[model samples]
Target: MSRLTDLIARTKGNDPQLGADLEREFKALSSRLPYGLNFERHSPEAVELPLRPVRKGDKVRVLPERGSTKKGDQRLWQVKAIQKAKKLADLELLGPAKTETQSVALDDLVVVAEFRDTIYPGLVSTGKVERGGDKPFHTVINGENYHALKALTYAYRGKVDAIYIDPPYNSGAKDWKYNNDYVESDDLYRHSKWLAMMERRLLLAKDLLNPAESVLIVTIDEKEYLRLGLLLEQLFSYATIQMVSSQINPKGVSRGGSFRRSDEYLYFVMFGTARPCRMPLSSEWSTSTQSDLENSSEDGSPVTPDWTSMMRRGSEAYRNDRPSMFYPIYADPITRKISAVGAALPNGEHAAPPKKGLVAILPIRKDGSEGRWQIGASELESRIKQGRVRLGRSTSYGFVVNYLPDGAYADVISEKFLIQGYADDGSVIAFSEAGDLSRVASTQWKIASHNASENGSSLLATLLPKRKFPFPKSLYAVEDALRFFVLEKKDAVVLDFFSGSGTTAHAVMRLNRQDQGKRRCISITNNEVAADEQKALREQFLRPGDADWEKYGICDFITKPRVKAAITGKTPEGGSIKGDYKFTDEFPIADGFEENAEFFTLTYEAKSAVNHNLAYARIAPLLWLRAGAQGLRIDKLPPEGWALVNTYGLLTEVDAAAPFINAVRQAKALRVAYIVTDDDRRFQAIAQQLPRAVEPVRLYESYLTNFSFSNGE
Candidate 1:
């Protein structure tokens, strides 16, 4: 045997417990299967490609090599076969020369797929709501969330305080799509494809979260919760993970035989010391408290008294079930004060009898049935020592046991004490000496206000009379979930990549309006039409490439309109639907959320040889958006293509470097300057002239490189 193995064997002989553990571990390792999570008939070599090479029947173009072809020599070719052994691909030439076949090196070809706005990763402002002041403006991006997330990494990487996403739950009702097709329930690899999509986006999202002070909240249903939990655990191993069951649908959806589904879950993966804020309990809970506890003391201090029934009422209340909890409590009969707690013996006998004039308090129900105490003998003794346990008059029956409210003397209650059956209203319940009841929010969130789907649809229907979107989350739910984390962080930046129906942005606006705080939201979603809608559009001779087709998709039709109506209190046709608030009694609906939001669509620059050859027109708007869209004027271009926006000077050409620096010197308070140039020497020379407060950033070299992707022509 090897030395290490021999030593372990010897150690096992000497220490059997440790040895057994090692033996079991070794057996577990030996018994493990070679592969895990096998998908039937799926082969990595046959199906999966990391870089996604052009396959048979794919349209492609020959990329011109240096000094090899004329400027317009490239032509579209249809791929026939990729011969891996020979590193060559068979291609058939298109357009008039239909029968021409040729073999070319793999490196000489590029896929000819149309470029998605997200794939290009540049922002083009479509419209804006001018607040006409220094108010924070929210952003809504109309593009694929994946590309939008990638673009955001350039500007908001490690800067966002929180990310809340309600991704498609992959329920089999054509709720979501993959590769432009709805993944049905029968699709064997549906789970795998969902995981693959989520993994890519989540990795990018992890970079955007501030590791020291952020939390990532993802909502999911029963279909993929187990797989998603494992994925979250794998990716965020360092975070403090918690899974909360949120009641979004009180009226359960019936599925015969199986349990009716009523609740979805929120996976809160918190990094560092991030925690939820405390919230006040509903007035119903406060009114239910005993009236005597609300009375003041002789010195005018609020008199706080804790109370609990002497008898245990649940399944484990029998003396035989928990003999340790069937202990005796000795109290002075006249004073009605607990003097000592007596332990129960192994034979279910009392350790000692009560002294003269002292009566033993046995746990007895109203029907005189034998029962056990709420706490064990050790805990009873601890409470007695702290002068918390007392014999008091019962409102329902005879003399009963009472105790001080846990943490009654402290200014605020700890979360641990609240978890011990303190209140039935919610997870974390707290009671103050002034008879005030508050809820200390924790991982276990079971609030009735966070109903899953109906409220969301109702709110949307109120905003846009006849329009409908499937399975939207309640706005109050999102607002409450964020209120737990960002209540104190008024200026925090919140991002939601899967921004369906724009609920997260609406929640943020509501929060800001309620608290008069400035919190900005960035929402990104795709403009893809539903499967049935796409079919209908195609039947009407409308194609995906047509602008009219896109107007009917989720981003343009649902997300944008919902956000606009929410902020403006007017429908898409400019009709006011403002009246009483349907969900809450606190505010009128017509008060209208006073906020500003800018809408932008993702666009791409023309394909170029050098990575940094992107034009100034494309890079300028992105800079404006990243700087919070302050004073953005896309209609007018400055003389030298250099403009001062907010606190930054954006120079598109190095030739305008002298004028840009002169302008920066003129405005001595410039915080930073972004210079777009391909030449390194020019960037350095211009950067040297800027003041110390003005940090210089090379647009193409530094900023743009972060978002550069391999677009196959």
Candidate 2:
């Protein structure tokens, strides 16, 4: 038996209840631990209730006295009876072992569930914005993010490249919700509830990321940075994690007798081979330390160049080891250019007769010992023509020779070597750029565009007139953060669950416009009304499901409109936005984006209510996203047995495989083939018939199939 099983058997001798309890506790603890050790999870315990109206026989946990300092009951209770007139409910303790009762106000008890509920996830299209091209539309899903994440796992499991989120900071204001109720600073369990909410959502988000190479970027402020860091550390213990301090507020927000708040923290959680890609330094670094650099050790020594001495050093430098490597490099002492390369001399023979017009540089050690060149005469001749072989400083014998080997040459062209100014000799000068987190002395990101007031709020006002969405992220700040991960990844599928004003998508669109990348962004947010808006709506007897209330939601009013405006170059008022995005890349907002976007709202569909053909329309978006989310989407089910689009092909019926195969072979742009079937034999045979370049995805009767994304086209 396993260790846990053995322990349970030994403990169940006198009481089986104790053993059952031990088993349940062990599994929960093991989920959080590295090796399922006995260390109990370190957390503030609290019960998170579901969002539903109170009903008879519903399990619940009574809320702690609101605005009171005391903690509330953490145990589950079943509603025994409800008095509608009194707005009170009688509750009995859950579980057969405990018999307890209480009567609480209806507002205090929130209906909860002890068992996991089933949900038939579906997407309903709300709108679309197009630039009249074949670009795969970036998507914005308007719903509670948790459910949206759940639905994404089915379509994009292990396919996402990066996830960047700027969730609510949980800063004691009612900026966020827990089980449909706004969690305020005065609530004693606010931190625990926030943690619980984030924990659930992040766990789901984890499924969507490619475990082999993906990054998770989360932005937070001072209020919850410490707790958020600990939570991430606990979840991703095996991955590399880091934090960055970005200055969003230059002047800083002041509190009585406290230091001004100037910065927020960003946690970058990298899994597998994922890491931050370096870029040309512009303004991500602070200039305040300029004078300090002059006084520092960096000014004391000159950095070494990648090109090494042609004379072999350290390993096998002698002529006897390799006689062919002992050749002469012919270069002019005045012009410092290679004139010719001389053949190697016999093993122990003396120097060959001198050649006129150029100085012959022989390999000589610093201690005056005979050494060999790194390469032979034949290779040296080819390298000299390509500028890889060059002349170095004059030695006592002659001008020393240097050469860039194949590996160093590869690094230069691949941008590992940062090109500095060249020397007088015309040798390409380059320096090293850091690939470490500790390269900077301080953690502050004092970028000018990161200023929240100017770039975030004011810039947002240009596209959206009079819409009040608090604390939207700076466009360039999100762009800079995303650029490090996805700049090189042209088709990276990025996701943002807490998309407030759609800045994440806007950032991605800007990135695409600059480099013409095919990167797609998926953003999820709820259409929640602001606190003041809720009060106003309630006064007019308009609740949440009302059309008037829904129209003013954050998704409908702010996120969707902002995305459309940013992409179409027109504000909500149908006028061109009058400003240029300044930082990293500069372009007028009126230039717009050559991109496409679609909007969706999450809907829970009952399988009993819909047939297979009708359900296909709901999941068409998923199939489009799975097929690289590029080119024209096969947006509907194949009307005539097969659907052939730019990026992928789909076969709806088995009998049409021959024509489908012919079409797929002809379309050079098609990279994926979706074959719908129930039989394993049919799927295998159909997949084998496809061209070598096309990846086959099999979708079965229940929508469960091998969703394979062949890494790249």
Candidate 3:
């Protein structure tokens, strides 16, 4: 053995695993050798020629050796005609090289084939699950970009149920990489890539949705909202579109020019739902609490407690178009009950008592106070019981109290009472206004009078932290959009390719926590700006200077920051963050290959020998299975009415009259043996003479390459 082989063998003898890897590399090198031309073997004495495969139709790239300076130059050849060796002189390109060339073997020429292109971007291949320590829940491959997204199209090919995309808006700040290129503001294809990228993802996304369930909602902004809409129309046959203006926050963007645009609009488009054009009631629901009301305490009133301001605001809102249910609320102090609840009538009209039982509160004494005011629940119950309440005469339900007012009137009067100033000690603020207490009536709230004190920011604050993550969407916003479709015990899969700071993930987490629903979110992000890296850096600051990064979040950082906040109750929105989150970083398998299976050796046998026959059985017939082919037809059968079969053809039977049949029928004589004959009746008749004899017959021809039967007679 060579010194190198000896050293490798010695090293492998010590480290078996490394030795196996080295051996694999060595074997791979042999299989990757360059292929070559074909040659005809007319005679063993004749020399071979270097020639290509003369197929009926073959298109190949040609490389010409034009530069003469090179000593060992090989000319580049392109596609030539399909001709025999004798007709080579007819081809123009073959004329120059024929004089100096000799016949060559067929294996000496490289063969080429036509190129095939695909729309898929990444490599998608099935692989076995590897179980060990520090592994993810499961390994899914070829999920990168177009490849991953397109793979989903196969299962949902040609149709889909719904398409929801939260792609990066290309704000010029966040990292949104497209095709190995960062989408910076300077690049012209920034919008094109964004569109194209979205276009491809959307095509696949669109196919996944069912025709009946074909509804797509894109949460995008001024950047590419119109473009996205156009793309949608082009991709989908039926497109009914609408844009909903959602007041996400009362605050506006400060451009230092004119005004800030605080609120954003969501483009809602539907293709095949029962209701299109009109915004359908979302399966998603929003949760409202005292936290949602601005400037008001948990008691639900304006901070300042100005009765006049409340009255003015109430009167204004009363005149404007508002939900009939939100009309004015008037109460009498005496019974401490609501007298009338509705919008004010026009032309200074006094609303008639629609119900006889309906009664407003009357001050017991001269002034309404803590002791003198109270409403009777039974009185209101009596009104309903007595049929005092009147239904609306027309479609518009005017102010009509069904029963006597039941609840106590709020302390502060007037709409302005919503505003409150700081006290000297900042302990208790005064409710300065007590405008009027004549009649409690239904009223509409005016848009202009809508103040901050009437708004709630708690729920909104939770999803959108204070600079925690920029442009973080409000959890309540997501809830409002998703609540309808969500249900208990239902497992839903939510995917967002444009996952930023994982708002969608957070929203899903919050939803699951509240409803105990089984919803999993598959968020895809390119980490363009290195969001994960930035998070790591921030985490480093939070840790001790000397803490090892690999081990830092191992236990402490087991959860993502968002997940940590979710579980630890450290959310921006006050309230408990719910449920435990398991974080797993998915990684691709290292680039290489591994052995799929191992083969074992077997001993030689008579049956093995028979299988190796060309006229009978082919040698190494077992190789046919490895060659990915199956089944064989045998034309002949064994003749043994009473015969002795050895191990090769075991003959273990004994019979006085029919020995061959007895031997053939012996169980000990045939482990890997069977029989056949051209004449069944003759074989059977002879077999009857033997105690335990059998017969064999022919089937078809052999297909095995190595099959042959050679015996010295």
Query: How high is each candidate's TM-score?
Result: 0.70, 0.68, 0.35
- C-alpha RMSD (angstroms) for model 2: 10.5
- Candidate 2: Cα lDDT at 551: 88
List the pairs of residues colliding in candidate 1. 248-451, 248-452
Candidate 2 global lDDT? 0.75
Worst 10 residues of 2 by lDDT: 704-713
Best by TM-score: 1
| Tens digit of per-residue lDDT, candidate 2, span 1-713 | 28878979888885686786677667766665453222333232222432246878777888654444333576678889999999999999976665888899988875553213344456778888888387777999987677677678767889899999999988877788664467888988777777777877788778888999999999998888888888888778888999999899989999557999989999999999987764444424635342323212343322333456677878788888888887777777778787777788877765755878777777877786778888888887777666676675677878767777776666655646576655655556665555211122235688888888888999999988777789888898899888888978988899999998999999999889888887889999888888866766766756455578788889999999999999888988899989887876788888889888989987654444333456677766677766766667676777788989888888889889889988998999888888877676887898897889998887634343221111111
Tens-place lDDT per residue, model 3, 1-713, is 36656766887998765675565455545444253311121111110111223332222223112222221213323323433554331112222435433322222232332111122111212222121121111111212334344434432343433334566777664456553335687875567667656665676566555556445667776667777666666666476676655555456666558667555556655656422211112111112222223223455433332111111122323323322222233443334344554442333333423445543321112132111112233433344343222221111222222211222123322342332543331212334244211221111111211121222233223422442334555544554344333432234444555544444544555555455554444444322224344345444442112234322321122113343343334543444543222212111111111111111111122333333332232222222211111122122233332233232121222223344443444545332222233344544454454333222322111211112211101
Summed backbone clashes in each candidate are 2, 1, 124
Any runs in candidate 2 off by more than 4 Å, and if so which?
Answer: 1-26, 30-115, 283-442, 607-611, 705-713
The weakest ten consecutive residues by lDDT in model 1 span: 41-50
Clash count, candidate 3: 124
lDDT of 2 at 149: 77
Q: For model 2, state the Cα shift of residue 19 in Å.
A: 12
Q: Write the per-residue lDDT of candidate 1 for residues 566-670, one digit (tens) a residue.
A: 877788888886555544335655556878888887654443412544455655566665555555444334666788856678787678778888889888445
